[model samples]
Target: MGLIDRFQALFRPKDRENEPATVAMPPPRPSSVLARFNVEQGRRATVEEARRMYDEDPRVRGIIQTLARDAVKNGFELVVEGPRAEEAQDVAQAMLERVDFWSRIDDWVRLTLRDGDSFLEVAANRQGDIVEISRKPTLEMYVRTDEFGRFVDPMRAYYWADRLASVSERPPDHAIYFAEWQIVQASWDRDEGSRYGQPLFASARKAYKRMTEGELDIAIRRKTRAGMKYVHSLEDASEADIEAYKQRNQAALNDPFAAVADFFSNKRTTIQAIQGDARLSEIEDVLHHIRTFWMASPVPMSLLGYGQDLNRDVLDEQEKQYRRTLEQVAQWVTGQFVRPLLIRQWLLRGIWPDGLTWSVEWASKEVSTVAVLAEVAKAVVALRATGIVSDETLLRMLSHVMPDFDVKAELARLREGRPDEIWRMAQLAGGQDGAA
Candidate 1:
């Protein structure tokens, strides 16, 4: 048995089991508007002053004008549907036209709902009617039109208003259907940047298929709209379809290989995102440490600029080479995640059944005549065992990760003799990313 095998046989954990690691959840969004209406509906104080401000502010005159035009042009169509349907569609169109009107409404809603009743109780009471109307495509189309019309345009607003109103009035479970349509209407009126917009869009889109086929009821159909908005505002996961994503990502956080893959794969880009999030304070410290060690050091050329070039006077050629090697080693070792893995036997060499086993101890080192010969032997063995070895790959992967070593000739020889080491390096480079 090899030395590593013998050691493993004697000391390996017998059970070979690992406890499940808890996946960390991202922080929740700061606000939720649908949730407010769901719980506090009638109990919350009306923001009458803010509502008045919207109507009176000249900055919003453009929106009021556009909404009034749309409403008047299609007044016969809107009022023919129902009072709530007519009011909701007009309000949505008007609010969408005003600059920053959605932001103002969001702030007002948040303030009003601060001490109101819970949204769950309200949702529970409205569930039955919501399910009833969800099956109708006509109603579903109206919901989408009125919702999207506020921000985009209202070309088909009349048809949608009529469809929604008709569905709401149809069943024994009328209240639930009406409440659900209102929820969707409110969600449509929300600002684009508001937490709920995307998911609501997704929900509305998915429900469209069922509604088209006449399978879903008005109530269940409307849930897709509200649920989607709730999902969008909270997690931003709705950009991808929910059903497909839930199936794919359900065990993503639990799979170790997948976790490690995602970590390194997203290392360069996600590090910046983590730094930007207000929740991740540690990212700043990590960035500071990396910058100090890796890129901020004084250049050797700068020392010579001040005429401090202690040229050949201080050391012989061999001694100068040693200093260069030491500097290379220092540069390679700083701020690396796998420093411990490469530190102990970086310069060691061994003969084994698998060929000559050399430790990846130092990334940068001064070469002696004997050390050079050992490096050549190590390269030959690595090539023979792995079927590939290259100087550039070794320098980037193993040599750089352990400690710096200046082995230019060895690197060149390995490049010509062994090339498969590149693949091995890629496999080994799963999660030891040190970049901040």
Candidate 2:
């Protein structure tokens, strides 16, 4: 079959083909008006507001950037298994390259966590191959699903607001709808049974507000009250006298040059520096709020340079914890975004293997995964001498030792390279098994 034909077959299952992508949903406008109704939604902060924080606040920006950077810093590999596993791997890699997937991964990762949800639009060429994978604004796109959480018909996903050009042609919020398989979505910290993903920084809003305000308040206080605001008190002086004194020193109060001009005064005005005010030594409460803001997000305080007293042991512990976090984030990305695109490319190529199972593996950012997994591989390979574990099983087990190793293809190569040796080894393993 042709590429376009296969593409249609892959996404349009017989049962779901007749159904629309969406139905009976109201027009989705880009506004926070619905926020009042869904008070508990996204920790009471609208997705729009969260996006603003990402742009304006350094803390929010840092947290999201850190998540994206740390998540993909080590890179990942796709492991495929099936009769045509090698072909599938080759095709998937070529497709990813064509669309510049890795090159623009930062954008995808940011979109994944920017508004607590990510929406990706898959664009295909005339030959029905995916050529572009671009991000749609999470704030503008709306998803409609049935009671079972499955997509409705052509309206499964909609993008942009209802168009001003023609309401009839683009009725669903005037948004152009996408097919079930056309859009790839990834949500961060999503709430159960909710359509939209919970933004990772939703809970940090209040603390961020306090932290930012505290810093600003503290800054203003330091500049204004950090030093003495001299009080020139007049003892039994008339209003005219006080007015004359102010008129004379008004320039000195504002301008340093004018202060040098304060040569003479009628009375002995003892201008004592205002003592015991704006003591910055005791603003622990504001610091507490700053720490609280960092604590609210997934990015650890140490990751953002907050813990000054962190020792090597403490840092190692934090690194271990962070590695675990990255693993989870990688899994979510593989499942929601990466895997689906691979499958889509497979279908577009019309050579996708049936019953194909695959996983994306990552190199560790902290620990040396190869050395650690190599030891595990050694243990697994030892089982092969017993004749119970097959060579293929051993290769799969050792797959962690080398991220790009294709188990099935490597097994085939070994069989081709040394047929007699393979047979002899099998016989020897059988003898060992019998002796055992």
Candidate number achieving the greatest lDDT relative to the actual structure: 2
lDDT by residue (tens digit), candidate 2, 238-283: 8898788888777777674444446235866656556645477677
Error of 2 at 422 (Å): 22
lDDT of 1 by residue, 214-329 (tens): 32333344444322111212233344444454455457434635523232221122222111223322344433332332221122222223224456554355345545644442
Clashes of 1: 44
Error of 1 at 404 (Å): 15
lDDT comparing candidate 1 with the true structure: 0.29
Query: Candidate 2: misplaced stretches above 4 Å?
Result: 1-6, 12-45, 126-128, 154-173, 231-269, 276-278, 351-354, 367-436
Residue-level lDDT for 152 in candidate 2: 45
What TM-score does candidate 1 get on C-alpha atoms?
A: 0.14
